[model samples]
Target: MFDGIKILNADADIQKLMYSSVLDWNSVVNDGTGEVVGRTAEYNNLTLTIKEETSLVKVTGSLHKYANAGIHNADDFTPERLAGVLDSIQKLGIGINSALNNLEFGVNIETPFPPAKLLERLICHQRREFTRHVSKGFEYYQCEHERQFVVKIYDKGRQFGLRSNLLRFEIKVLTMQVLHKKGIGIYTLSDLLNQKLYPKIGNLLIQCFNEILFDEPTIDTTNLSKKDSDLLINGRNHKFWRPFSESNFETKQKYDTARKMRYRQEKRFRQMIDSSPTAERLHKLAAELIATKWEILSNPIVPLLHYTLNVEMGQSIIPTAKECPITGIDISDQKGSSRYLSERTLKSDPELLKSLPVTIGQQRRRKHHHPEEYYVAHNIRNAASNPRNSIKRRIERAVKNTPLFQADEVIRLTDEQKKILQSVPSNVPRNKKPR
Candidate 1:
């Protein structure tokens, strides 16, 4: 009947307790005491005995029959039902040994296991009860036995749910130890528990238990509520929610700015597509542009820039670089450079240059003939009379005002006028009347 059960780190106290209970049964069968000892044997300084009467039977052994039964039936023990118990006992033994060893070595026991194991054990018992119906012959059991089993399992599961809630409370107590060992930040627990960090460990835990609980709606609701409670206790509420308070005006402002910037970027892209009859082609071009920008943003360039800025500043304070460190050029060196500022620089720059929109104007003219040359030349002539603002502003104006120019439509200038406009430079000074 005990087949497939496993006992791990079985404590002597638990063994003694089981033995004592069996001995009581033996006493009942034997009319109390050694009056009716049926069989007894000793081997390796340990005793084993079985006593039987008309209506009762009992077995006892000095070798710890309970441990033997458990070990022999290890496979019968489901992890959901027994893992916490086994882990607790093992941790207990380790704790005692650690304390003893420390006393011997003259060092204090630095870390102690919390009540998490007790809570875990409770959870295991709950899971065992929930799965009890699946056990062999459970259907054949008497109504009383069935009711008792169901009640026991339900009660255990409820108790476990309540007790496990304390884990969230223990976060503060465990935080220092976790940070010390893992080198994580003080707020790591909050960060992990926050909904912002969902799809990580928090999601995994929720999914694991949901599967275990048969995906019942009631259990799912309870789990979510419990998780929220845990989050609040672990300071995750503060991590995610506190920034919305009136006192955090600066943070709120920055968040609003970012939201607006994203909205504007999307709106502008939509407008560009709306202005074009070739929607599909424009969409493909937009997708390519966005993908390229995402790839560039994901590169290690930002971190490298931060490092360079730090080195140049010679301090750990804010790292700022106004130029592309690798290319040794100003921030506006590239064709559409104004949009490439680091997030940090955007946050601090008084003019908020990065918040301005990107502008893709017509390409500049090359010396020789090319299909794009006419368009470039037309835009250059259009912009020539206007004073240049920042490179980004100039591009923006050009993009807003210039229509797509056709190559065949270039205006023919008089030969003399063309010669005067394109006059060549000379190394030799021209002779002139004395002035």
Candidate 2:
């Protein structure tokens, strides 16, 4: 999940590594004195900026691309892959304790539809409007200008010309204190080398995603009472709801009033969705996205289909004893009756396996190794509770029927789609001026 990292105060030996590994090395000269101060070079996805006088170097590039041979980052950056990358850094005389200046971590989720639709539905994040930008000539959407971090949601499939609906949702942490605030004890690059920190990182990603307020234009409200329907429809209009979350008041009491009113509005909207039958699909879709992301963060090697089987067939489908997905070593005995370890650790690493708290209660409380499995299974078992179509069941069926990989098509929005996009709050069109 690690991508686009920046490291500062790199060692002088890094210059040697760059000489061997990097391409297009050029001298950065002092414009007035014509004396060379530093050198800049570009590798496939790694950029190196070196100041020879101070031995201070700055490295900024996509660690994901480096791991994938500079191809694309649509695939998972597994624990094993990260270890290998860390080893490469060590070889370059960069300590694992090297402090990162900036960090970006996110997963590429395979959506069922064009990611542009999801991007279009994004209204705002934490009362901040998402700005549209063209990066490297490719269009993407992001919510930025916050001091701590930026929330980015972009079409990975379109960006890399991949044949999948790869929607990349990532948090670019501008300040390391943000991670500390989130209870993620990651100070150095080596801290991330451990498998334990992944869950915390994944939690941060999900929290950022949840903070984004989405406008579901396709929600159905036909069965609702007049008042309920009006609320449902009007709540989705970004223009109508933006004022509630924004604090324009001069006095503290007035600000508190707006805060209380905003909370009430949000509660009402959430209550409506929870109580209404039409929102079942939206809830399931959200659950699926989060569950799938957690599953990948927990165990990237296992295929998504394996979870599908666990949901559909339960333990009867998986063998009584399961081997490590990476090394194929037996670990079923490690977790007692549970077929697999919750955080799939390599059998070769006994310390990692032993690190797991094996108490029955802790075991039960452990994050599911297959989060999507339990999620889908739970929803499938309770399918009859929902009057509308079972969103989980539909998703399962679709996944089962669809090919593992398929080409993502360019999105050509219909007139109706365009209208919905235009209605989204704060998303001013290129040709229009902000009111």
Candidate 3:
């Protein structure tokens, strides 16, 4: 019975009238027509149709039942109620606009599209056709993935609540899927909200969509090499490609031989020091020889000349007053003692003293002490000479140097103080001089 109902392209005036009206099922139905049939409203697609009735207004075809209901409802419907309902819808539109303004992907139009308008028109047309349609409720439609999804509002009381929840859910799910496919992980509903509101994220989303979906194909990774792969891995142990060359082999062989020689020399030195009875003495002598050699190589001329000059000058070369004076026993004895230093005789000699060069540490310590003492004494002398009295001296010098009286200074004084200063007698009274 609900077939061949052709919905014509409604005129602007009719469309406006339908949206402005607030007709419902119970309000449109007339009980006098031998068991009135209740009209069902599809909430999802927002479509409504009424059953044909044999009455004063006969509706035989698809348009018959709707026409009958519309006539009946319009006869009793008040203009004030219709206006109030229209106002409510207008307010809802305003709210939706405000909400879209804050969205990352803002609404494309100032008003709802043709599809939305079609649904709205059908809703109002059904309401006017059936008496209890508004009281019974309506449906909303969602077209997703090439499939139709319906949301039925059976009870009028839940119309607003259900519609709001479904709308919010639909928006969230759509945005999540879109963002997720673009490599964005929507961990929570809050993430979607943030992306929708945050300006940076919103701009990034637009940029990503423009580049990946609309821009030219530019990324080419087909020709990537092994070196590129190693770089991408960012690993220290990664094997890098080395060019095949004769020089490479020669360089590797040289490095290996030098390393092997260094290892053998170190091992021999370690074994020698570990086995010898005078190992400590030999090691010390080696170290001293190396250090002396390094010094000689660094300044060969200066050190050699200095030593030669010392020998020529006979400094510390003559024998001490206690030793044989004529033979200069100190020099001859030192040479003889150096040869027998490993034996016990030289060690037991009461007159002979070991001669050793001062170490770097000892020289530094000797040089640092006098300079450190001098700095400490200098600071102490400065503190004693000035003391805290320097502050007083500075203040006294400033006071003496500055002009005691000035026009600006007089201006700064209080009126009473200034008057008192001006009234002070310049000369003492004659009577006061007698005292």
Candidate 4:
């Protein structure tokens, strides 16, 4: 989950990336797979893409230029900064990438109420209003703006939903994990969504719900009345909103000192519990467990970064391809890419990572020729163009074969060898035929 975050700074002119300019190049959109990838990318070497699956847009590439256009000199690598920047993008109205342009928010709430019943209370009491119910817990309301609006409650997992175009602000949550996405990727909406709509909705739902699920109820099970719930929702204290808002790294920094103090207290509490634990009864365990769980649960597991990984470094090379014997169109990989040098040296020596990719990525093809044919062709070309290298090679061969000096019979030498040896510099040693 969210182990590392890499920020992309644009190399190209920022004016060129204002809107859909980056989207113009070799682009392909696959609605079936929910993906759009573009290439020449102008800004970076390769254009980027937006991948949608599980109802969340995963953006790759292009972000560097996009980020560069929006801001000035400030580091934006942490989760909080990442969230705020993404939010700012939609607010600025430069969300050209369709997949990420649609603003969405994801919330994980631990509540006792089922989604269907909770939606019922919210609608019935008019705590908030909705236009109509679509499918299971999926509701639509007349948007403040005339864009596609969605209010969905997930029945599948722990009272959470991942949807698009629900809100009209941005916070791009890109954990930018090359491999996995658990608590990773862009998992945020605008802070406007948080400060206004999200809290009120969550407050209403949590306030109106029961103490436990309907299927498994305790002896003293109870639900909140509308009047009492409303009072609690509008109260000064914010038990629900505080934890939710402070989950990302940026927000957490605001209360850094307080969180550190709480962390210390919790650490001591855990130690105390481990040493003096005599909880045989359910009540005792419950009393001890809830506080610890609440503390741990509120803190986000991963802290994201806006650190930059250069284009050549972040991208993986294409594997070697082999054409089919029959069709020739069907290509399969024969050998995989070898990135041993790039991966190992990147940590200690970043400048070294620049060269190899340019070498491999920008390769050219020429007319094929046989080994002997190329040798002869190259030699012919060399002699016809500039005989300098050819003459040097021939001279070296002649010199090695017949040295300037020779010992045939006694200490006598051939006239040719003698003249050659004499012409040589006095200080320069001449090789002789060994006896």
What lDDT would each prediction earn against the true structure? 0.26, 0.61, 0.26, 0.29
Per-residue lDDT of candidate 4, residues 1-435 (tens digit): 011112232222223333553345444566787565423233322233322222222333323224555222111222334444444443333232222333323232222233343333222111122334355454432212123323333233321252311111112233222111322123222222121122222222222221111111122112445643343333212222122236555665666865675445334433332333331222222222222222222222342233221222254212123321111111232222321122222334444334222322232236754333233323322222222232234345546766664423223322222332333221233474311
What lDDT does model 2 reach?
0.61
Clashing pairs in 1: 4-73, 4-74, 4-75, 4-76, 5-73, 5-74, 6-74
Which regions of candidate 4 are displaced past 4 Å?
1-106, 110-113, 124-128, 133-299, 304-435
Candidate 2 regions exceeding 4 Å error are 11-15, 18-24, 220-250, 273-287, 300-335, 339-435
lDDT score, residue 205, model 3?
A: 28
Residues 119-142, candidate 2: write the lDDT tens digits: 777767776778899988678888
- RMSD of candidate 1 to the truth, in angstroms, is 30.9
Please report the candidate that would top lDDT against the real structure: 2
**Which structure is stronger by lDDT: 2 or 3?**
2
Q: TM-score of the candidate numbered 2?
A: 0.67
For model 2, what is the error of residue 63's alpha carbon versus the real structure, in angstroms, after optimal superposition?
0.8
- Candidate 3: Cα lDDT at 395: 40
Candidate with top TM-score is: 2
